[model samples]
Target chain A: MTDLSYTSPRSGSRTANILLRWALYIMLGLFALFYLMPLFVMVITSFKSLDEIRTGDLISLPREVTFDAWRTAWSGACTGIQCEGVRPFFWNSVLIAIPAVLISTLIGALNGYVVAQWRFKGANLFFALMLFGCFIPFQVVLLPMARMLGLMGMAGTIPGLIFVHVIYGLGFTTLFFRNYYVSIPSELTKAAKVDGAGFFRIFWSIFLPLSLPIIVVTVIWQFTQIWNDFLFGVSFSQAGTQPVTVALNNIVNSTTGVKAYNVDMAAAIIAALPTLFVYVVAGKYFVRGLTAGSVKG
Target chain B: MTKWLEEHMPKLVLAPSFIVVLIFVYGFIAWTAWVSLTRSRLLPRYEIDGFIQYDRLFASPRWDTAFTNLFVFGFLFIVIAMILGLILAILLDQNIRTEGAIRTIYLYPMALSMIVTGTAWKWILNPGLGLEATVRGWGFEDFTFNWLVDPDMAIYTVVIAAIWQSSGFVMALFLAGLRSVDQEIIKAAQVDGIPTWRVYTAIIIPAMAPIFLSAFIVLSHLAIKSFDLVIALTGGGPGYATDLPATYMYTMAFSRGDIGQAASSAMIMMMVVFTIVVPYLYSELRTKDD
Candidate 1:
């Protein structure tokens, strides 16, 4: 490449470089449209009236924009026996995701601290078992979990769902924190231990302060996961207790009435908004968390 | 007493989660395996009855369709997502001006739940209301893109949505891999007059083989566990034409009240996952230790 550049006059190579750059840009722009088209359709349809949506092509900008579908999707769209819409289910998701994220992150942090700092007998084995939890298909646990929920008398409830999320979430959360903490110097903990610091003391004073970045990653990952979950949301909870994902499914797939395409689109967007907001706000951290969680742990 | 307590606090702090995983993950697995061997129904009955459930599971037509669909969906989803992701990553690696914005657009779909993807695509694929109608409206008069309702092609609709949702994630992984390649080596290759495409094919791509493997492992597991996407898009319909194993297991367990069959199917799904995962885990852990 260098020889060619040196041998050739600068003008011809510059032209070739400009042509290549334009070609790359055009290709990327086309692919970008492919990725954005569904989202464009989703948003455009959501703001149209049902009649307008019916008459218009899928790709057309709405003739008239209205918030009617959004209003109905938020407050009045029927999901089975309930006419109250996805509002309650939205709150249900919030209730479930918050506690689950906090508990999972907290436990993950402590577990990561102990495993990374203490290095007890069988620590690696315990960590491995916990890590294995990350890959087990939720199907493998459904029957027994149902039974366990029944025996515990928490079946079909939000707390039961939280319990399930935390338990399942422990794997990735622990992995994130463990991997993060492992990169912290063991000498810090050693010094703390030498200063008459016990495990909790050293962790709280020393490790916890340094854990903010990982905590953010774990919280965001767990929140997005639990928020977007449908299998557990549908399986573990009944109609009244279902999460936003399940309720959105019920609304969109409900076959008894005239299919409200606009309302369905609105509901879908509503369901996706939280995670979208998180991504837009802290995209860097989210990508970092995703890659770190994926490639390493 | 204090020393003893301090000495034991780590274990004590770790005990709850350990116990939870032990029960919720491992113990439940054992329980599900046992239930598969039993004659459980809408309500679990603890009478251990041999391989009746497995035999029934093997004999069920629905299970067969579900398994076949899993193969098609899993294979197509993984391969297409990997290739597309690699291409997108390579394109982005050209250091184009809009790389960040383009990358973000590609990745945003991953943040949305599968249900959302399904619902959005369901609208776009709806024959009467979506692309078919719109295309026909454009004066073609005979344009039809109705795969969503076509029983034979319904499963591929799922593949489309799944790939759309995940390929960006694969691209991100590959982009990270691409960026980490030693630039000095690339410069040396360039100095030798190796073409840019040849540099990628001969040097960069081969060096990123581990990223490819990791992406494959991730995407395969995701494909196997796909449920919500199918549920939202097709609901395993035009009459169970698109049932993946995960959705099939859900139907048997919850809707059909056939816990025995559900357990058997679930066990089979786990075995599929284990076959892929265990070897990966073993190799990964061994390599880490070394």
Candidate 2:
């Protein structure tokens, strides 16, 4: 092992470095294409006419662009008895995600505030229990959850779905907020307490404002998760209230008619758009939330 | 009274969520175990029968296929994703000019749901509509890549889709781990005349063993719980060729109207998850305690 630093710097070494750099670039570039290919195919196929799509290769550019598929996918594509396309279901997802994200983030913030700042006798145990929720296979809970929903007479409803998402979502959201809040000095809360601020008062004035970053992480995470969830959306909600993912699945899996490849691709893109939009617009926080929630939590 | 109320407020604020977890997470697990022991169909019944449901579940060929597929899919998915993720991370760790853009491209897939991943891959792999047809149309008349419809090969298609969705996530984790490695250590290795690849192989990677374990734990659990991906991609079709445990449980619970079978399968899935996760949790918690 000759020390490069101790040896005279050589053009050969520099060339080897440059070559290695180029090799890395090329390999990374190829994988980038692999990652982007399905998306490219989805977008291009969505834009192509059915005939053009049939005629063209999977990776070929469409001869003529068309929004017919997008239009049908959004407004008129049939999903079983529903011929109203994915619009209603998309709204259903929006409806479910908003309250679920809000409620879960809020509760998670409070939970984090308590567990991190206002530790009690069983705080660590409670936090541990909540954290365990993050790892349980949702399948394990599905049967009983359905039964619980039925017992409560909230089965197959949007509210029921929201309840389910919020319930399961608390683990991750709480983890995010707790991890974030844990880094904040307890002196802030202690000072507020010294000034006679109660728990809610301190949370409202001190913790909440300081919580903007974690809230963003939690909201983005919860929104993306609840929005993209297919299992609960499919299992807990009926046809009229099914989320976009389930509708998209039904539309794609529909066997009654000829497979509408173009429409299906368009619908897939449409279903993916909200999360993708969040990823593009707030991708930094999205990734931060992901890394924070997983790596640290 | 004020002092008492103040002392109790945190617990009260935390009570609802705590109770929810108590019932939903822990209690439901118990209930599910109980249901597994009962002879229930379509709807649950309370009469406890012995291990009949487990016996039936073990006997069913669908369950066998589902268990086998779970192993195959989980093993391939975790290994491929980790390797791809490690490679991508190492490459990106080279201080490339386009690292951010390339990383975003790689990670954007993770933001999308498995349903979207499955649907896109299903179309891409569709025999008549996707890769095979397109290749044939390009005058590669001998070409055949119809795994989507090929019963024997359909499970691999699911693996491919799962890898696509998750590898980027794993990459992000490893990239973070790579970045957090001490620059001094690398410089020390370089000054010691260690080859660059050898330095990474011997020093940097070994230092990130925790990240590797964390990534493995996350990936394994995800692989175990995969449901939407299989549903959106194969629907466990070509006659139940790609039925992972999650989908198998869903079918038994919902479509097949066998509550006992569903509960037993669900319990088994939970056991699989517990086996993977509880040890990880134990280690994590023990470290935290220390």
Candidate 3:
């Protein structure tokens, strides 16, 4: 958020107007604090020792910043079910998310290309069918999907989770690509067709190259959705395959012995880092993805 | 063969995904619907048994609590988030310095998973140590803010965390909408000596009905599907007090071994979603043709 300062001109006497402007800034700042204070608290708390956490206040910066909590959170915190920490689960998430994101984005691009440029009979209807998948509660599919995964011998496996993600993610991915591809003139495709191009040829040579922006949006969208997922992670996954969100929940919510607040906070932050990194760096596209994914066409 | 393959290239390319959606999405939904109608216990029994599971679901007090919690959580979360989002957007719309920075701060939570948000809030509201202790330490002495454990208030804690996560995204939406409002109309209102607040209330806000609806749909859908947040924040506890339908369904099928009740609840959830979304999709598609 750059501060180029294009403050809309307001109508008031000088004293009143300046006061109002100050009040607005204060209010905005307060809200910003409200939004940001948790992340700040999480960071500071993650560094504090359990003694300091027990002794100090929530808003105070740690007296002695330590990485021990992070180490414990990353490698050895007991999550009731296991004591190896969220490291394995985090890797499980990475394993699930990378392939899921890639496959979903690739298929979504193709689906989008077909719907937008290579419209065949009933493509829009099929596209609409796919779009409808976006809104279906995963609960509705849980019973059968579990059964289906079990039948396929992929139940409680990383590939099953990936398959589930890719299947559900197709809607948003396809929507992104189709909407983007539609903005390009069809003449490009037609010209290529006249010059003896096949379906994958024009798509690979033209549409795929032209789809970088939408691809970024879709990848970020898919990555965040897959990485952050807990319902699917918990439902379909067994002991070793759960995602970090599930593992983080287990670590934080575990009722065993003395609660490790610092470790819990560190584990939470560790789970949050990837998505937080994406938001901070590519926030503009993240916002674009939200808007694109939300508005139905 | 080459000619046939060339002619069918587009269809060939699109076939797999089409089949996947057909079976995975549409097919599984039908399967769920079928399962919901059966008397399945620990495992699925495919034989039809009518709406007996629904009778069981509606009869259960836990489901009742979960159903009621959905409305309370959904209403408060959606309403407060939109109100706060609109206000933040309005403030940021003032061309203030640091608008970009404030906007970034506000929207950063959206990128995080609900689970992360839940965990952070869980820590923040950790009964004695987090908010209550911090506030009491400030010499308020009796300033009790233990919503995290109170069964009645646990849902509201979920609402608060939800608002924190989603309201920023709403702010972004409204900010975009505010920025897109016709400049000429605002200028004309200003030229006519209308106050800024009136220009907003009487014109700008009214023109954003579409945005409000979109936000409402998004927020409500999220509310209905809110399982992860509750799972992390309260674990739908203080013992099922924070349970929404999603969690209820999960508990019944996975933990409790009451697959019939789970399937039925899942159907009801889908029905709720369809009622909200079908109309919205209809309106959107109808308008798009023009």
Q: What is the TM-score of chain A alone in each candidate?
A: 0.95, 0.94, 0.95
For model 1, the docking class works out as medium
DockQ of each: 0.61, 0.61, 0.62
Clashing pairs in 2: none
Worst 10 residues of 2 chain B by lDDT: B188-197
Among the numbered candidates, top DockQ falls to 3
Clashing pairs in 1: A1-B193
**Candidate 1's residue-wise lDDT over A1-297, tens digit each?**
112222323325667877866887888888889899999999999999989988889999988899999999999999997988799999999999999999999999999988888898988898989978899999999988887898899999999999999999999988999898999899998988888988888888888888888988889999999999999999899868999999999999887788888899999999999999999898878888888766884
Model 2 Cα RMSD, 1 decimal? 2.2
lDDT of each: 0.90, 0.89, 0.89
- DockQ, cand. 1: 0.61
Q: Is candidate 2 or candidate 3 better by DockQ?
A: 3
CAPRI-style class, candidate 3: medium
Worst 10 residues of 3 chain A by lDDT: A1-10
**Candidate 3, residues A75-155: lDDT per residue as tens digits?**
999877589988999999999999999999998888888889988898978877887889999999998889889999999
Candidate 3, residues B1-290, lDDT tens digits: the string is: 99999898778878999899999988888888888899899988899988899998889999999999999999999999999999888888887867778889999999898888998999899867898899989899989898888998899999999999999999999988887788778777776877677888988899888999999999999999999999988998998899999999999889999888888999999999999998998778668657
What is the clash count of model 2?
0
What class would a CAPRI assessor give candidate 2's docking?
A: medium
Model 2 Cα shift for residue A27 (angstroms): 1.2
TM-score of each: 0.97, 0.97, 0.97
